[model samples]
Target: MSIGMSFGLVFGLTLFDNIAMGLPLGMGIGIAIGASLDADAKNKGKTI
Candidate 1:
């Protein structure tokens, strides 16, 4: 979330734009990626 906001600012976006656009997008993507990895780990454990 902070990463995304920083990136937006670095790229010349407004502060409001950073929060409105970056935070939710970054957090959602992060959550999806983490969920995928957790599911993969569980599957690997089951196989083993």
Candidate 2:
């Protein structure tokens, strides 16, 4: 899920840059989820 979100955000940003012009919505949502996961992992004492 986190990975998916990251990919989605990347894809969205890329699309916005006209590099792909794909799904921005999915990208935004994915980024949010990924960020949350990253935070969680860091809090868990995991190397992010």
Model 1 lDDT tens row, 1-48: 455445555444454544567556666666666677789989888541
Candidate 2 lDDT, 2-48, residue by residue in tens: 55555666776776754244455566676788889899999999998
Which residue pairs overlap in candidate 2's backbone? Answer: 5-30, 8-27, 15-21
RMSD of every candidate to native, in Å, equals 5.1, 6.3
TM-score of each: 0.56, 0.53
The local lDDT score (0 to 100) that residue 13 gets in candidate 2 is: 74
Model 1 pairs whose backbones collide:
none
TM-score of 1: 0.56
**Candidate 2 deviant stretches above 4 angstroms:** 1-22
Runs off by more than 4 Å, candidate 1:
1-17, 46-48
Evaluate all candidate structures by whole-model CA lDDT and list the values in order: 0.59, 0.68
User: Using TM-score as the measure, which candidate wins?
Assistant: 1
